[model samples]
Target: MPYATAPDTTRIAYQVRGQGTPLVLLSGQANDHHWWDTVRDDFHPARRTVTLDYRGTGMSDKPDRPYSTEGFAEDVIAVLDDLGIGRADVYGTSMGGRVAQWVAVRHPHRVRRLVLGCTSPGGPHGVERDPAVSTALSDADPAAARRTLLDLMYTPAWQARQPGLLGRSTVLGDPAMPAHARRRHRLASARHDAWEALGHVTAPTLVLHGTDDRFNPTANAPLLAGRIPGARLHLIPDARHAYFEEFRTVASPLVLDFLGAP
Candidate 1:
């Protein structure tokens, strides 16, 4: 229930769990802190995990304008400032990775290390979601939107095991999300192209992707790894876009090793 006031004065909601070096987690588009519910406990007990709900999602105050990736990165900084966390490791997934990349470029001193998961460099070569799936997400029915998201997010095996994952869709379907906010998010996402900005990021980086990701192709991972100096890439086999959920056993250990390494 903690809230941080952004420069625009929007109250962004965030939650902090566990205890150790601070690690801020930025969730993907249409997702909130709840996306980390399953893996929150997987990090080292000594490592603090901070999960945030972007302006229009979860318990955060929704605003009418300024929903760019740059805006979201500012929101993350405001949360860190509120908590007196001067510098921390950052982990971002999908859209969150875009924000993380911006943070690394714009506020390099504030991030010690960076982890980009299921994300792209966001240029002409950046992978795009299938039009059908994208259309389904903007549907009026919450159920339809959730189904579309799940279909785009997970592999068949993950969906079969967690048939009820879409039940959590109500968080995104909240009435607080105005039509304009949704439209702005879509516009920002579509227009986002960070390839030009990648060379500006100086943080030690890690890129994680799934071999079978349908939403964003795994090939994008190697492209990113090749672009960022000293960056390492890891691809999970049989995993889809949502590898964190589908292959937690493989994913968690890899993350822990990378994050906890001396």
Candidate 2:
């Protein structure tokens, strides 16, 4: 329940766990730290994991104002500064990944390593998600939105095994989140364009995605990997948007190796 004050004077809530080299985990779209609930344990004990709710989500202040990936990145840096953490490994997924790009580019000295998952560089050069997917995800009906979000995230087999995943998956346009905040999150994410600034990232980077991902096209992985100097790309075959959670058995070990897990 600890909090940090963003430059805008907005209060950002964050949580810290374990005790080792800091690892910052960023959430996607309109979601909060709960987005990492499933994969967090994979890095526990070996790293001091940090998770936060963006200014518009979770336990943070929800302001009726403009938001951008750079702004979100600043919020993250503010949290780190509050914690007295000078630098740390960063892992961001979906919109969070886009925010991480800005963090690495604008604040190079503060990132030890970077992991971008199921995300895009944005603008014209990036491969965008299908408009239908967006339409379905942003459906006015909460139940329909949840169904679409779950479908886009996990495969049928995976969904079948996890009986109530649809109920639990409430990141994007869930009714629990304020409508204004969700719009802000979507707008902030849509405006993210990091392709031009990616070259400045000096941290060892990993760009990963699920091959079958439709939410954030898998094609963006190679584009990101190629743009960033020395960045590596990994695609989980047959995995969808929730690859990190569905295929953790493979994804976790690979990321752990790259992070030099203790």
Question: Number of the top candidate by lDDT?
Answer: 2
Question: TM-score for all predictions?
Answer: 0.91, 0.96
**lDDT computed for candidate 1:** 0.81
For residue 59, model 2's alpha carbon misses the true position, in angstroms, by 0.9
Cα-based RMSD of the predictions, in order? 2.2, 1.5
Worst 10 residues of 2 by lDDT: 167-176
**Candidate 2 Cα deviation (angstroms), residue 221:** 0.7
Off by over 4 Å in 1: 135-145, 169-176
Backbone clashes (count) for model 1: 1
Give lDDT: candidate 1, residue 188.
Answer: 64
Cα-based lDDT for every prediction:
0.81, 0.89
In candidate 1, what residue range of length 10 has the lowest lDDT sum?
A: 168-177
Write one digit per residue (lDDT tens) for candidate 1, span 202-223. 8889999988777777788988
